[model samples]
Target: MKKLFILSLLVLASCSPKELTEQERWEKHAENTEIIRDDFGVPHIYGKTDADAVFGLLYAQAEDDFNRVERNYIWAIGRLAEVEGEKSLYSDLRARLYMTEDEAKENFEKSPEWLQKLCVAFADGLNYYLETHPEVKPKLITHFEPWMTMYFSEGSIGGDIERVSTRKIKDFYEPNNQLAVSQGLIRTSDNEPRGSNGFAIAGSKTKSGNAMLLINPHTSFFFRGEVHMVSEEGLNAYGAVTWGQFFVYQGFNEKTGWMHTSTGTDIIDEFEETIVKDGSKTSYKYGDEIRPMDSIEVSLKYKSGDDFKEKSFMTYRTHHGPITHANGDKWVTTALMWSPVKALEQSFTRTKKSNHKEFYEMMDIRTNSSNNTVYADADGTIAYYHGNFIPKRDVAFDYTKPVDGSNPKTDWQGLHALEDNILVLNPPNGWIQNCNSTPFTSALEYSPKKEEYPAYMHSFPENYRGIHAIPLLTEATDLTLDSLIDLAYDPYLPGAEVLITGLLEAAKVAPVETNVAKEAIELLKKWDFKVSESSVGMTLAQFYINTYYRSGKIPNMVGNKRISRLGRFEYMSKTASPTERLAIFQQSLEQLKEDFGSWKTAWGEFNRYQRNDGEIEQDFDDAKPSIPVGMASSSWGALASFGTRFGKDTKRQYGTSGNSFVAVVEFGDKVKAKSMLAGGQSGDVNSPHFSDQSQRYADKQFKDVAFYREDVLKRAKSTYHPGEKNK
Candidate 1:
């Protein structure tokens, strides 16, 4: 009987199929996945499983912009110096200071089985792309790994770590004795406000009697790619995905949609540690009982001509966090949310949620530390979470600056509960909007009361974009997708209303000498404060405000509170002398004339949109042909923000950021939507899609989003598996 059983076991073992290699397994996943490229070159990926869908999503992203995909991972994984040389050494160091490669791998190992599979797919997809495309050369990361996703779990551009200055890190760690660390915020003329505009309207305000959502992420142009990822395992999501990230950072599934705006809620904190080193061992003072500080040796590599060089540093950390910089004589530890596993899970599971309840439960994960979510669903629900992953701190302690690390009371008790956080659930006003502004004014009368929440719960003062969105939404009636688009691109610059009017009033009080100034004032006097291509008033206003930001003496501070951009306008109106105002105005005109040969250049002629090449950092040439853009900066209260910059030796300002990906969705029996991209889906300059949507973007003409498979097939320009030839 034993011999017969052994013979049967051997027979069963012999019948079992051979184990698959990594390449073979990837090929199998590719077989299960199908990518349909629409006429606009947006990839609509269909897969048999969630992992397969993720695999194809990353593969499609690589096909579109592998340079950006690999570069994102290289920067995230703390190896950018290996490509960019010594200049990026501190950036790599900052990444390692927060989370090392071993720690990232540990995070991947600690993740749940389902999440682990997704991470594996994320790596496999990129690796397979490298394997199939031999012509493509990577700058740093030759091979991808599942653990690399841990470094870039959250999709917010520049993430929380970017707030920690690399200069500060270098001064603290660099061996050079002359290194200087500048403390406090260095105020400068930012290109435009770094944020997004998300508006959710309930059924009461929409024409379809269904909820509506606007996904408008104001990011660096070409920062994200538009995609539609579908899987049989209940993973159908469509929206803008940050390059190389496996999940859609901001998008909607069929039944629900979510938009993320950069949150002002304080998530990163600095703890001033009192160091007490005894011989080689290091310790820190913590309420008299000294606790030993954690120490680790970090090794980093950088490119030196054709060869690579290595540098090592011994890093210190306290219970609070890693010692990032020094304050006076004390080493400061920067504490922030670093839960990679939970953050990745939250980011992925958020797209699969079907209704309000599921979304609310998902929000309970509380790992999204840098964004405030505005939500709408097919179930007639509209909601807003002011900020998630807020830590419960003692109200007695001020957290705006570096706090005493020795004081035990300053330690975070725990995270605030989902219900305890500031939120708006189907407000009576039927609308919710967050332009990276104060949540207390999210829904006017229905908005959350500021006093009801902790001081740390909300920090952002109201901005011009929020100021612009309020009145439009207050009177919004029977809203549709196109109407929402119209509202978002209203062209009225609320920011210009105050600054331009104030300047004109100043001119009325004290007349300026120059004829150009008088002509500019007359042009402004007739202006409706609406930005457009043909409007010369827009050109003058944009140049003038930019000049003021650079040269004006208006203090950024008013009493104890820091003045916002809108507040600066108030100060310029009430404080700046008429002489100073006219002087600044004259400077602006002279500057414009110097650049364009005429101060009266139309906005379109001055403010242009050009895509010269696929380089991450573009070089603008005045000689190149470019299209005129009607959009203005969000600083001027234009909801359709077009943050532009004048390249060296170039007269025209080309947009670099703002309104990278904008979408409006109306949820009902079937989802209805329209979307726009800054340039187009492909990053290769030779690809037709590289500049296909640039004209449409400038014209505010959004194309229909094909969410369903039938619609996708109808618009399909090409179709293929991940590793197959296009058909």
Candidate 2:
């Protein structure tokens, strides 16, 4: 048996094929250009035209995180297995299932002209960087097509980015049983979600009397922040850019600004496969003849040391979407087509748009993935809209999951007419806010009527935030920056009016123990149904609730009257009695004392966004306090697990992931406005400006960005290209 095994291994090794060397891929993308690295490392491209700025942007991003960005696109092309091995097999198939090369190409053509220019410019920018920087080796990809941007579309990364979705998740090793998940018809549990918070106090509402936009987007540290790209051709904006992306997907220029928060609305769906007939060689099925089962095999490359393997996978689908998961204990397939490329084009052009008419035209495209975008500008205009390219199905099938391919009724009836599904022009309230909540609650009394739309539209994330935002916005007769700030930081809703009124009643009955539960009960009792930072009860209340909140528990809806009635708002029924609540509080205090050797601790002490580089020495004291920067906790309370840390010195749990790039834009009032990027102005360590903003960022501070030529000239440390650096 051992001899036979050895022989089998020998034969396998002999049959294995060699994969491309890292150098080989690098050679394919090599280009040349003059690069000047300013002392701060913010590249100042001197290209002959707009494309130069793009090329410079790509090269600069490559310098910082080429590996991660390249990997991002590798997965986009449905070739993740080439680099990640067996673990990525399903992800590749999922990509192919949802999106295709031909589909992407076709969609690219359909994309708007300005959007295509930016993409093409982006490709040129990358090509320029490669030409100038032959020393940098591309791990897998050396060339990028215009449509490659579609593969790495901002939505594709939810497979990894801010929010994790159920759409493309791989079956983790264990099969035959369901893996644990935050299951729901609608997930309204984004209190600790990954998001950003922004509010515009229009000239009508602000002391400045100039429209003020708080362009704050919460994403990962060291992740992409705002980049000011300028071309005499009238291209300039502020917002997040993932490495090589040519334009800001979410942000503001002078005339208007925008913010995007994820929505649970089903923008993508999957369909099951049916067999009408089997043919020799290649198989073709009927679409109406018997309801066709669209299937395609995704071929992937896998490298195992000296050898490479090709992986072929079958993805099945109907007209609606791809069949991602297994169907009836058999292999199934799904098709995906978000056409985000169209949206990307819209975003690129809209950023430069000078008026609302153009903004409305851009909004008409509605090719965006699952997020609601809120807009504000100097024109005294503020708005929010939802529903991006939803597939109009047969209306008889469930769009939430895999539909039957055998049933002809499951076929999509083209896309919904943009106007039929467009939910905008919300009125009454002058502003709109979305903390990853339902789009219907975007504004106050003026929000879109639920009855006006169909049930198929994603009506929720019927979350506490939106529930909280509504009363907060409506109840205020007069709105201001101060009021907006207070609302963004508001604590939980009122106990008296909430679903757990019964739980509070129950809390009154439990056997009492320590002050921990007592304090929690006391806060809950006196709670004003608000999250204001100064609320005396809110601090203790949030802490206590944090302890009681479990991730996987079904929601408590009975006491949810203060908010919208949701599917699983029943968790309130499980609330502890006052005595029991007191016990929890006392236990918490005691645990903290034991853990830190003292109970006296500030909220900042526990929750920190600690940057753990693994190089910082372990200190037992206030040694590694996470650099405090960005918005406060509970303000943009998303992705609850993210928090500031005290590092090893003062160990404690805290959350952070908001306002990485915060700007206070007073439109037209000043050429330069207040802005800040977390960490520092320089991404490179060699520069003295590295992390210059860390201290200010920790303090929620701002710096004046160079909006004019003189301002940039005064502060501009160094300028360079992405290619070969010429000192």
What lDDT tens digits, residue by residue, belong to model 2 across residues 1-727?
A: 9999999999999889865453442232233223344333444443434444565566566665565456657756766666656555555655666667888887778876756655665665555556656886877788877888776655322422213233334442124325342221111123434555545454555555555555555555545634666655676665557555666666677677776665555655555555445563322233455554566766767666667887565655555455555555433444444556765766566667776677877867766656666677667676666756576777667776676655667766777776776465525455566666666666656667777776777655555545655665555444444444344445445331343354366656665465555555565576555433244343343344454554233344436333333333343344334554454455555656666554544444454454433111222244554543223443323211133423344555433345566665656544335666666544455545456666666554556555554556666665543434544
TM-score of each: 0.96, 0.76
Clashes of each: 0, 74
> Which run of 10 residues does model 2 get worst, by summed lDDT?
181-190
Candidate 1: clashing residue pairs, number = 0
Which has the greatest TM-score?
1
Tens digits of per-residue lDDT for model 1, 1-727: 9999999999999999997788887988999999999999999999999999999999999999998888788788888888877777888888899888899989999999999989999988999998999999887677888999999999998688888888888888984845343321211123668899999999999887999999998888898999999999999999999899999988998999999999999999999999887998889999988899988899999888999999998888888989999988899999999999999999999999999999999999999999999999999899999899999998898999899999999998789999999999999899999998899899999899988999898989899999999999999999988999999999898878888888988998997889989988988899999988999998898788778889948796788988878778887665788888888999999999998899988999989898898888788888999999999888878899998888888878889889999999999999989999999999999999999999999999999999999999999999999988779
Pairs that collide, model 1: none
Give the range of the ten consecutive residues with the poorest summed lDDT in model 1.
181-190
Please tell me which predicted candidate would have the highest lDDT against the true structure. 1
Model 1 misplaced regions, further than 4 Å: 1-19, 175-190
